[model samples]
Target: MHGCFWHRHPGCPKATTPATRPEWWQRKFDGNVERDRQQMDRLIAAGWRVGIVWECALGRKADGALIDRVEAFIRHGRDLRAEWP
Candidate 1:
């Protein structure tokens, strides 16, 4: 999920909601999170393992580590939900 500020990414500096029409942004973010929740539930019901690789993980210093983490997730089959280091 290549989400933007719409998903309300926790602790990410880039995930700030729009300033204009704060109420509308809140409603939109609420809907976005709800949709993500429903989709995640369906995927879990289907026995699919899900992982969230945040966009912040793709940067100059962290990109290499992020790739390694992704490879480990695929190869080792471990449940992981990593955040900013």
Candidate 2:
């Protein structure tokens, strides 16, 4: 699992580009996203289950159900996804 901004988690509030330097921020963010994608791809290909748990998904309201989703991915290799309702 990874943080939203650093890993470019979809729909994350913190994943926004800085307004002051839009171009630079976009490039940097794009690179971060690309790197994460490549890393996930490699891990999956190597038989390791990988996932991204966005920060937004860990909000107060979603606390209880998150564990269930994580357990499912870890135990059964079910689709590794966790997001806010």
lDDT of 1 by residue, 1-85 (tens): 5455766777778889777999998998899889987887788688776777666666667477777877777688656333333
Model 1 misplacement above 4 A? 60-62, 80-85
lDDT value, candidate 2, whole model: 0.70
Q: Any idea how many clashes model 2 has?
A: 0
> Compared to the true structure, candidate 2 yields what TM-score?
0.78
The number of clashing residue pairs in model 1 is 0
Each prediction's TM-score against the native?
Answer: 0.80, 0.78
Backbone collisions counted per model? 0, 0
Tell me the spans in candidate 2 whose CA falls farther than 4 Å from its real position.
60-62, 80-85
Q: What are the lDDT figures for the candidates, one per model?
A: 0.71, 0.70
lDDT of 1 at 37: 75
Residue pair clashes in candidate 1:
none
